[model samples]
Target: MIKIGVLIPEQYKLLSVAAILEVFEAANKFQFASELKETFDITLLTINNQVDSFFKTYKTDTINTEEKFELILIPSFTTNDIKNTIALNRAYIPWLIKQYNSAAEIATFCTGAFLLGATGLLDGKAATTHVDACAAFSAAFPSVQLKADKTVTQDGRLFTSGGATSTFHLLLYLLQIHCGKDLAIKTAKIFAIDMDRHNQSYFSSFQPLRHHNDEIVACAQEKIELNYQDISTIEEMIKDIPSSRRNIVRRFKQVIGITPIEYLQQTRIEAAKKLLEQTAQQMTEVIYNSGYNDPKAFRKIFRKTVGMTPSQYRDKFQAR
Candidate 1:
């Protein structure tokens, strides 16, 4: 049996924790119905051996402190204050690190990536969390390669999934790895979850990083947001700001996590998205309003950044 340890953190998203357990239980039920031996030896591992959700209390079997689990599952957190949440769960980090050192695979769902990253096992590894938390995650764990666009990321023994529902995708992926593709598909069908999702970009709102305390970069960001359509070049932006071009570029990257040009592109794309959703603008008009003259270039960037073409996005999200 594959020994799996589910870490129950205090004040976690109850649904996420429940969903994971239910999925595994369903998988086991299927195995039992087929007269097959049980495949998962599941244990609820926690710091105190008891956890309280927003709605109820749970007490379950815990892992022996010295025992090594084959797999450890970290559930999504309920709170937006991830810094506080991580600090509250700080005690789990050393335990997780020890498990990883003992050759255990670790998987995290949504903001659980924050906790997983806290273990330092995700350093130098590719991982992802909720789309909105990407900036904070990147800022917090600068060494971990945050795959902001990916819905699921697996780096050897470490795994992470984007946002709420994407947790099911990660679970399905793990099921496939441990059980089989057939069983994974069966489980997905049972749960009515799409098994083919791979990108979170389609659902991500392009909120630029603005909270970093760089006054010059903040001013430049405001300029970009206010005049993205009128503005044409980094040189023009530099002329408007007091900083040198290199300093602006360096500071912008440091604070914004993207180059000035990339930020401008994202801002323009966001504008274009609004126009596409709220107005019956022609593609040419949208492109021009988004500060781009080339239809080809606009389409390419739109598809790359939004995970769909402009027309497809319009069809999917246009105002009713």
Candidate 2:
């Protein structure tokens, strides 16, 4: 049997934990039907030797601080404040490192990558998280290559999935790797999950961070958001922001992880996307209204950022 340890960290999402258990339990039933024995020895490991009353049906054990498992699962947390969540779950770091050194594979779902990255184990490895959290993750772990567009990323034994439904894709991938493609296909059919999905870009909403204390950066961001449609250039929009263009650019990048120009482009793209989804406006009108005079440039950037053409995006996501 493959030993699988699912870490139940502080603030762990109940849905994430439930999904992990359900998938593995389904796989184990398949094994029992065929091989007359379960293929997995699954255990929920927690630092505090405690579990909520909701999970009384499943196996729960306090982490021994010393053990080896073939695979370890890190489920996403419920909170957006990742720094505090990681600190709350700090005791898992050394245990994770010890298990990895003992040759255990680690898989994280959505923002769970933030907790995994906290261990420094994800340093210099390709990983991803929730699309909404990708910017924050990049700033927090510069050494780790962030693939925001990918629904799932695998670097050696470290596996990560994007957000929400994207977690099913990674579970399917894990199933295919361990149990075989036949089982994976059957499981996907059972769950109504489209196993062919691979990119998360179209699911993302460009949420510009606004709570930072940098007044100058905030001013530049405000100018970019307010003038994205009317202005031809970011410099023109922020010319009256009371700082040198170079200084504004520096602080903007420092605070926002993207340059002022990039931020403007993102703001414009978001506007275009909203129009595509919610309005019946013509493509040309959408482009110009989104601050792009050139349809070709708009289409190019839209495809590059969204992983699909404007028409395709609208066809898929437009409101009925």
Candidate 3:
């Protein structure tokens, strides 16, 4: 039996915990029906080893820390403040590091990556979290490679999932790795989860980091967002700024986490998405309006950024 540890941090997102447990519970049922000898043994772990009281909405259970687990799952937290959340749960860091050292695979759901990253184990590894928190995550953990476009990322034994619903995808991935593809598919069908779903790019929006106190970079970002349709917007921005083009580009990248040209392209693609979803515009019109004159170029960039073609996006999300 594979022992799975579900870490129940204080003020955790109850739904994420419940959903994951349900997936495993359903998998157990399937295993029983199939007369499979192997099954998962799940345990609820807490920081204080005392889960005496419920968190108002959900009940919490305590587990013995003496037992070793093959996998440790950290569920998302209800708090938006990553630093505060991490600080509140500082007691778990040493335990988590010990678990990792003992060969336990760590998996984080949504913003739980912040807590996982806090352990210093994710350094030099590719991981992902919720889309909206990508900038903050990147800023906070510079050593970790943040793959915001991916719904799920796994480096070695470390695993992470994007956003709330993407937790199901990560669980399915874990199921496939542990129990095989047949069991994973059976579990996915039981949960009605789409097994083919992979990338989180389709639902992600272009959220540039503007919280940094860089007035010039902020101005450059504003200019790009306002006039992304203009092909020479980058040059115009460079000329309008007081610093040299190279310096401005460097500062923009340092502050905004993306280059000026890349920002411009993302801004344009975001605009194109809005048009495709909200307006009855043709593909050519979307290309031109998004600031790209060439259909091929626009389509290529759109696919690269959004993980789908213009028509596919429109068909999937066109306002009915």
Candidate 4:
């Protein structure tokens, strides 16, 4: 059985908390138990037994540390909002770190990544969170490598995700890994979500980076993400680098296996994907906002890379 625990504290983000509940609800309603057996189990844990407005209370003795959960999920809320529970809330940091040290695969959604970060389990892992918290998270835990792209990231035993509904992607990914693709597809269909919507599952190897040297590549990657709207030409990119354009291009291709331009396009497309999933922006607005000045070119490239037009992609992920 795959034991899944949702560590809920006081004053959690409604959407982040809801995402986990909804995924399990979908799993139960979509017949995952009939097909997958007792493979997926969801348990809610808190610091105390008292009920809060954010979630219903479950009995404290219901969870056993020896039960061996395969996954522990933490949802996001303000760090200061956990309320003043000495046993339930305050015990979270130490208890979570202990849980992480066990055999279970640990994960978090949005700022929930902060809880994992506080535990120091992600000190040397690659993870992601909502973009707004990236800089603060980086500064707080300099050892963890944080990426802002896509919804989910897995580094060894740890998995972290970004955006609000990315938690759904995270749960679906676990379902696929533990149960199978067929079960995952079934649950996704029941939710009216597209199975093909961003197929980069957590366990898959990411595409190669474009720069050979870690420092240079990280710098260049950061620049691309930060200045996606302002970047225009290869020469402009080279101007930001201390090395010559020829050397940077050579190193980037050697390390990342793609040209700078290609990486930039991928970045913009990724940005567009997030916007389409999260907002109601028009196609033209998404194109321009993602740094594509020419809407026609954006459409062609988006189609070529994603195998769907921008509108088609948007329609696929937007709530049914």
Candidate maximizing TM-score: 2
TM-score of each candidate? Answer: 0.91, 0.98, 0.89, 0.58
State the TM-score for model 2.
0.98
- The residue-level lDDT of candidate 2 at 33 comes to 80
Which tens-of-lDDT digit does each residue in 1-320 have in candidate 1? 88898888876887888888889988999999999987888777777776555424333555447777899999999997899999998888888888888999999999999999887888999999999889889999999998998999999999999998999999999999999999999999999999988988878778876567788999999888888988889997777788899999998988778899999998999999999999999889999999998899999999999998999999989989
Q: List model 2 lDDT by residue over 1-320, tens digit each.
A: 89999998999998998888888888888877876678778888999879889877777777775658999999999998899999999989988888999999999999999989999999999999999999999999999999999999999999999999888999989999998999898888878999999999999999988999999999888878888998766669677888887888888889889998888889999999999999999999999999999899999999999999999999999999
Which structure among the candidates has the greatest lDDT? 2
Q: Which 10 residues in a row give candidate 3 its minimum summed lDDT?
A: 55-64
Write candidate 3's Cα lDDT for 276-313 as tens digits: 99999878888888888888888888998899999999
- Compare candidates 2 and 3 on lDDT and give the better one: 2
lDDT of 1 at 319: 85
How far off is residue 318 in model 1, in Å? 2.4
- Winner on lDDT (1 vs 4): 1
| RMSD to true structure for each model, in Å | 2.3, 1.1, 2.7, 9.3
Ranking by TM-score: 2, 1, 3, 4
* 231: Cα error in model 3, Å: 4.7
Question: Candidate 4, residues 1-320: lDDT per residue as tens digits?
Answer: 56778876755676777778777767665565476455556777765545455555432322335555678888887553222322234567777777667777888887788777877889888998865556456766889987755578899888888756677788788778876787788877776665544432221212334334567766777787788888977777767678877877887775665678887887888788788778998888899999998988999988766656778877877665
Which candidate order results from sorting by lDDT in descending order? Answer: 2, 1, 3, 4
Candidate 3 segments whose C-alpha is farther than 4 A from its true place: 34-38, 49-64, 231-233
Model 2: residues >4 Å from true position, as ranges?
none
Candidate 4 has its poorest 10 consecutive residues by lDDT at 199-208
lDDT of 1 at 276: 94
